[model samples]
Target: MINAESQLFATNTSTLPLILIDFDQTITLQDTIGPLGKFGVNFTQNTKPWSYFVDSYLQEYKEHRKHFFDLPKGDFKAFVAQLDSYRSIERASQERLSQYKVFQGVTRQALTDQANLLRAEYLQPGVIDVLQEYKDQIRIISLNWSKDWILGFLKELELSKDCIFSNDLEFDESGKCTGNIIPTILTTGDKQVAIDTFRQQFKTIYIGDSLGDIEALIKADLGIIIGNDRSLLDSLADFGQETEQDIKKPSSLYRVDTWDQIRSLLQQHRSI
Candidate 1:
């Protein structure tokens, strides 16, 4: 296990480690996708309620899960390939949203306004302190739908906006959403690509909490899974069982239940 005694963090200032954090569930207390969808539905003039889209999306997701949920146990690569297959479900959902113009006519100002309102309610406790302490070394990488939303939310919290790297919601010249998404980081494979891009320059410590983060978490120099997400935990347990691996191995991967633990761990690295 990594613990406070590990020498992994013995490097000097010039070689400070990089922290790649997942935004949606890792940084926030919960997933904001539902709120973001409701925000868009509220602003749109669509005759259908938010439930219409949500239900449709859930149906597709359920079908997708049926085919891939068994998971390839012994082979980690095959397991990740199953996770990557989620891209098809994501694409279909995005396409349906665009088809229905679910977010069309939603103004940028409205999004920022909503973000201001959500900043306090949704942010995870101690996130600000962690972000501040690792300001120079941290990068927010997410599969969130809108980069503007993440930036606006962080700005409202008085955090750095330039550190965000996520997908974007296409907006027209009038600063209104076009109900379309630019699919940049939509899958686990895409997140791994982002991690690899940074791995070229510095040692990486990836923190995340979901199926989408599986590959990136495994690929990083150190991976920290935060929260008690049952699905994620079960999947990792399955993978570990087949491979006869221990998930608590600190040198590779570990799980924690709170940000304070994460902060303490990061501090351990810095103190060295």
Candidate 2:
């Protein structure tokens, strides 16, 4: 499951400013976790219709989610404590997520058909276009998903698969998913670790959409928050107003609703 993601995208030696992004809701209009849950349900229906595994896991996730949102933003210890506090439920939730097939009760072609239908209906407009225009400069750092699924979903776009860094998904010899994941990016603190490797080499620009994204946003040389997630937006605003007295290091943060705006901003700064 671990291959070189860098090989797919290093088409040039431009030394351009880096564009780091999150997948799922940030790039697509639909979040991937929901579809993954749907896959679990489908598995039960096709195999053990009497099994309550999917339903049971969903309820467990609901419980884990209750306290997961309450954890502090940048505190890794608190985050681990939150996960440990809900370990009875949270660990199982994570296990279920760590394992799942690419398809259940369907042919690969049929799965692709359904995926395409979803793409037409739910994908964020302009994401593929903007990414395509700047393919060589982008690296995706996704938290929740395995690399295979993201690349599979975006293969039609011919996106260079070089720089996507995500957790690993294991599969059996028969291609059935195993309930084990190796996470490279685990906490909000780990985001800073991920970005540090790129900081000295490029003008890192991080783009993300949720509260989990805040740590990286603050750490990037320039950060862009997309969509109207009020919690994140307000946090950025508060960080700007309450934290600093010096005008010299004023926030280089920007918020917008569309990829087009990001394109315009990047185009204006690409020379730098």
Candidate 3:
């Protein structure tokens, strides 16, 4: 269920440095697998049973890719119902979810602390440097699936707001999660709307990994593929397109090896 995220401000069409970033593996060293898996384990003693349920569902979901996207828009009830209907859950999996223990001793603060530690230790070391270098020049907007997670995560990292768009999470009066996403932004390939919402005027650089990023990436003046499993950029590069140009340079479609390399490239480009 994709929901509209909170925005710090409306799009600033006045010339601004506009940079769209992917928050998961592209920025962090790891993806959501670790945190999500930990959540599963803490939920029950028989973690494997739940893992199997999720893995099997994912595999089957991938097998019928088109149908997955064919799901109705803004229909959270139907969407969740379909998702529940498709899965073949064992009794163990059902019990695990029912008794879900979101990791013992894992208060939101503890998980946040660990996430911050990872950001300092495993994230691209030069990530901050590059961002700082272009700090005054471009708006570093993050687009991601981790709605509330991204919000809380960035606050820990001390990154500025007015530069992020993610899924929306609803919280109850006690501050516990309501388990419902509102005005979902991750529903369809709606990333462009995020970019469009920013309403910035600059050479747009859209960076991401999956097909989910296709719409905005294609629309950007600069399209960067980061750790993409799908070879969507091969054809783009074959056309002698530089990041700034429409021409192709297939070999130039690089796979990031380190954060320092990213900093170097961005700094070098900014100087030109």
Candidate 4:
């Protein structure tokens, strides 16, 4: 079912193959943005706009608590439109929306620490093992909303450049963020573009969760849905699994709860 005519492509890899992961639910245990937004809303003295923004934003995805990590992009007006269409927003008991800016204490130290903590606790326990096991066979790539934050997380993990894609952040002279995100913040559709940019040449596979992963999941030579509920994934291919418990023990796609499952699945596919 590969879209032969589509421009999906990737560079050849003699080294480890590439992997893309959803940051929020797939890696970190919580939606990092809500906290940052909360902090921003508070930092701004609970201004109407900021508070409305926070309240409105969080309320939009209340039903998809699992998809909390998927961040939106572009201007406030556009985001407002997105909210207007979201079922969570429509179902909310109240219509009050606040535009609060919650800053998450994103100093270099705080951000770095948070990334490290996420890697240690929230990320799949055997992530390093999978990466190490496939070190020469796979590469790692990411498409996430907190591009800068993801970049920082990669840096903390010591991943090389070219292994990640995120939005650009402008910093002040003191190295603090200027409270602006790049317009091209990576989204589900953006990963296909990133793949094209790489001109990848290997038999590729992509792993992710949620509707945001539809493009990449369908584009890759092989696609895997990590959290199951594969009504969408089923349409793409036979690769879908639920492994939250395995993720708690190890990280793999073969078993249901660990990153090791991904490693095993890849190995099985490669063997075939």
Best by TM-score: 1
TM-score of each: 0.85, 0.72, 0.61, 0.60
* Total backbone collisions for each predicted model: 2, 2, 17, 56
Tens digits of lDDT, candidate 2, 1-272: 12233332233544567788988778877687566446545654434322344576667768667655654555655643553354355345455444443233333333344555567656678888888877767778876545655655666556544567766555566664554555566555555566666665567788888877777777777777778787777765655523222223434677777888778767755634
The residue pairs found clashing in candidate 1 are 1-250, 2-250
Candidate 3 lDDT by residue in tens digits, 1-272: 01222222213333333567777766666676456445435543544554664775566556655465555544544533444443332223333333443333233454455555455654655666666655444343333323435545454335544455654334566665443333334322445655765434345666666545544566665556665454444533433433332122332334455666556555444421
> Compared to the true structure, candidate 1 yields what TM-score?
0.85
lDDT of 3 at 255: 45
Residues 28-131, candidate 1, lDDT per residue (tens digit)? 98788888888888788677788988898899889888775554447888877877888888888778878888888887777777876998999888778777
| Candidate 1 lDDT (Cα, 0 to 1) | 0.75
- State in Å the error of residue 220, model 3: 1.4
lDDT for 135 (candidate 3): 46
